[model samples]
Target: MFQFHVAPSGDDSWPGSAERPFATLDRARAAAREAGGDAVVHLKGGVHTLARPLELTGADSGITFQAYGYGTPEQEEPVISGGRVITGWQERDGVWVAEVGELDSRQLYVDGRRAERAALPGLPGEVRVTATGYVTGGGEPLGWRSPADVEFVFRGVYPWTEARCGVAGVSGDGDETVITMAQPAFGWAGELYNSTWEGQSSSGPGLPTRIENDAAFLAEPGTFVLDRSRPGRHVLMYLPRPGEHPSRTRVVAPVLERLVSVAGARDVSFRGLVFAEATWLRPSAAEGFLHYHGTGYYEGGGVETAVIGEGASVTYPAASVTIPACVTFDATENVAIEGCRFTRLGASGLGVTGGAGLAVRRCAFDTLSGAGVEVSGSRATSIEDNRVHHVGLEFSGAPGISVSGTRDCVVAHNEVAHVPHCGIVVGSGQGARILRNLVADTMEVLADGGGVYLSGPQGDSPDNQALVQGNVIKDTHTPYNFGLYTDYGASWVTVEGNVVLRADNTAVLVVGPPLENVVYRGNFWDQDPLGHDNPPSGVTYGGNVTYKDERELNAATAGIQSEAGPRR
Candidate 1:
C-alpha cells in the first residue's frame, strides 16, 4: 500500500513524504490518486482548517484517511475544522464585542461550549396572526435599530417540530406593533398546516413563542447575539460566563457548510480524527424552516395523510426536505468510519445516502444541532458501538441515530443519551436488527418519541423479518414517550428480551397506528402497558415479565446494560 502524510505545519508544495507532509487533505488526496492501487493518508495532530469542502470521487477509491501516530506516545488528535476563531474582542458595558466582517452564522461556540443566541423568553404581548404578518395588541416596542434581523420562533403544531420565520420589518409606535414577516415563508408555513390537525391553534401557523437576535436581548450570561444590520460592519456581542474574560476565551464561528463531501466513491475509510465546527444556513434564509417530523420539512408544500384500515398512506409534499450533514456520503460503496469524533456541528454529524456496505463503529457524536447520524437509501449498513449525546440542540425533533429507507441494517451495542428526542429510530427498513443497545435520558424536550422508536413497515416475507432484542431503555420522562415504541404501521417484527426501567406517560413496548404481525415476548419492564392484557389483531404478547419493584427490575437488566455500549 502507498502512503502519504498531511499536517498543519506542512506545505502543499511538499512531496507528502513522512518527513515532508502535505498542508491540506486535498493535496494528500491528490497524491493518493496519483499513487493508484491502494493508499493510506496519515493526518497529523493539529487544527487543519478548510476553506471549502474536501471532495472525493470514485477515482480516489481504496484510500484510507487515518490519524498519524495513532495509539502512540506522539499521538495528538487531529481536528478538521470549518470554522474561524474570533479575536480582537473588546469590553463594552459588561459585554464583549467583536467585529466579524461580513460573517453570518446562527451558531456560536465559546470555549468549546455552545452559546445560546440572545432571545426574549416569549413574545412581547398578546399577538394575533394576520395575512400580512402579525399585530400585537399591546406592547412597548418603541425603538430599535434593526427590527429586520429579529426572528420570530414558533413551535410547530406538533410538539416535535419547531419553525423560525424572519422578521421583514416592525412598525407602529405605542401600544401596537405591526410586524411584517418575510415574504412567502411566513405565509407558506401558516397555510400549509391549516386544518391539518384539530390540535392546531386557530391562528394557522400560530404565534411566535419567542423572539431572537438583536443585542437588546443579551442579558443572560453565556448567550450571544449577532448584529448584522450594517452590511460590512457586522458585530457580535456575547455575554460571558461567570469568571470568564474576553481576552482569555476562545470563540469560534462556522464559515463553511461542510468539511468533507464524498460521492461515487468506494472502499474509502476514515478513522481516529475529529470533524468539528461547521454550520448549515438554510434555516436562517427567507425560505425559513418549517419542520414536519424527524428532519423532514415542507417548503411551499403540503402533507396529506389518509389512514386505511390495516393500511395507511401519506401524500407528502413535492418538496420533501431534510437537514443536510456536515460530512456527507452519496452513492458510495464499502465505506468505513471508525473511532472518529464529531462535535460542535451546526447540522447532522454524518449523512449516508444511497450507499451500501457501510460501517460506522466506536465513534462519538455530540454537541450537534441536528441528528448524530442519518442513513437513507443505504443497504447492508451497520452502525454499532457509538456514543451519542447532547444532540438535537437546535432541532429537537432529530433523533440521535435515524435510519430510513434502507435494507439489511443493524444498529447494535450503542450508547445514546441526553437527547431531546428518540435515541435510535429505524423507519421504513427491511431486515433490520436492533440489539443490545443502551439508551437513557432521552425524550427530555419532545413528545411522541421514545428511547427506541420503530416506524413504518419492515418486511413482507419471513426471511426479511425485523428483530429488536436485548436492549435497555430507561428514563424516558416526557409525555407520550415510550420505552420501546412501534408506531406508524410497523409490521412483521419481533421484539424480545428488552428492558424498560422507567417511562412516564406510555409504558414499555407501546404500539400505535395499527401494527401488523408484531410480537413482544420475554421483555422486562417496570409497568405493563395499558392494553397488554388484550392487544389488537396482528399483535401478540407472550412471556413478558413486569416487576413493580425498582430493585427487581434493575436486577433483571443489570447484565444487559453492562454488556451494552462500546466494548473498547
Candidate 2:
C-alpha cells in the first residue's frame, strides 16, 4: 500500500509521508509508474482541479486514486473533481471574449447588448460581419468608456458568423434581465445567476422548458436566440443531458464513450464519484460507474448517480438516461458489477451486446425510463438478487427483464414490480433458467401480457427452453388469461412446482401446435380449468392443488396436500 497526498501546492516526490506530501495527480501517477507495480494514490480532502481528462494506462492492477475519507463501512466521504478553467479574455471590437483554443469559446456580457462586427464609430443597425458580436449594457460597453444605466439584458451567439450579441431591455427590480440565443452556439452556457425569460420562442418550443433551472444547456450547433421579454433567473448550460448526441457525433462525451472505445483494457475499477449530467453518443452497456471494454471486474462503493440526455427535462415524459441499442464488445470475458444504484435511465438500465460470464448482484434499478435490463448476443450471464422496480415508460413495451440471442443464462431470485408488461421474459434465448424468483404486481396494463412470457424462434426450433419452477407469482392482472405463456415454436419448456395467487386469467396458458413438450405439474393454482381443451400429450398436468375459492384450500376436507409432487 502506497500513500501519496495531493494538494494545489506541493512538490512531487517519492516516499510521500503526511509531512512530505505530493502535489498534482501527475507526479503521483509518475511515482506509481516508476514503482512498476500496484499503486494507491490517496487524495486529500480538497478540490484537485484538472486541466483535462485523467487517463490511466498500465498493467491491470491496483492503480487507485481514492479519497482519504471515503467508502468505509462506518462512514465514507469521497470527492474527485476534474475539468479545465477559462483563464484570460480578449476584447475583440466591443465584446469581451475568451477563447480556450479552438475547442471552446465564451463571451462575458449581459443579455440584449449588441456589439459591432466591423470597426465603426457608433453601434450600427446592420453590418456585413464575418463574426457574431455581443452588446454589453448597464453603463458603458465593457472595456470601453461610456455611461448607459440599464439592467434588462439579452445575449446571443452566432457561431457560424463567429460573433455574439448582448442587449439591455428594462431597468428596475421589476425589470428582470434575460439572455436569449439568437443563434445556437457550442460550449456550456454560463451561470444564469438572477435572470429569467418571460416566454420566448425557439424552433423547438419545448427546448427551453427541457432545461432545468440550474441545468446547463450545450446548445445544439446551429442558429437560435435568447429573448428576455419578462426577466427571470438565468440558467447554466454545463453538463450534457443523458442520451444527447453531439452535433458532431465524433466529439461525443469522452468519459462516457471511453468504455466503448477502449476494448480489452482489463482490471479497471471506478469508485466514489458522481457521473451525473452528461450525455453519451450511444448508450453504454458496461457494468460499472466507469464503463469497461474488456474482461474486467468493476466494483462501486455507495455511489448515487444519474446519466441523462440533453433533450430530457423534468417536464418531458421520457426517462433522462438513454442508451444506444448497438454496442460492440471485443471478446471480453468475466465481468461483475455490484453495490450501485441506477435511476432515471432511458431504454434499459443494463444492456449487454456480446460477452461471456457476466454477473450483476445486489444492485437496485429504479425509475427506469425503459426496460430494467435488456441483454442481447451474450453468453452465460446471471442477473441475480437485484431489486428492480417502477420500470416501463408510458406507451412503451417494457419489461423488468428482457433477453434475446443469448445462451445458458440465469434470471433468478429477483424481485420485479410495477411493470406494465411481463415481469420476466425470455425473448429469444435458448437453454436458460427462470427460477426461484418472487414476481408480484406485474403486468400493470395493456391487453396481451404475462407474468412470465417465453417466445420461441420464429422458424424451426423454439427460442426459449427453460425451467420455470418454485416461483411465487401474485396480483398478475391482464385481459388475457395466461399467467405463464409460451408461443412461436417455444418447446420443451416446463412450468412446474410454483404457487400462483390472485390471477385474473388462467394460471398457466400454453399456446402451441404441440411441436415438442410443455409440462405443468405439482403447482398450486387459485383457479381450475372449466374444461380440458388440451390433454396430456406434449402438455402434462398432475398433482396440483386447486381452489374454487380461498376457503377450499384451507378447509378440512379439501383433500389437497400442498406438499405433494407429481401424483400418480
Q: TM-score: which candidate is best?
A: 1
lDDT per residue for candidate 1 within 104-170, as digits (tens), equals 8889999899999988866666877788788886544435457778877777456666777888887
Q: TM-score per candidate, in order?
A: 0.95, 0.49
RMSDs, each prediction?
2.5, 17.3
Quote the lDDT for 93 in model 1.
91
Structure candidate 1, residue pairs in collision = none
Q: What is the clash tally of candidate 2?
A: 52
In model 1, what lDDT does residue 132 have?
Answer: 78
Instruction: Give the clash count for model 1.
Output: 0
RMSD of 2: 17.3
Total clashing pairs for each candidate: 0, 52
Off by over 4 Å in 2: 1-72, 75-330, 457-465, 507-515, 529-533, 550-568
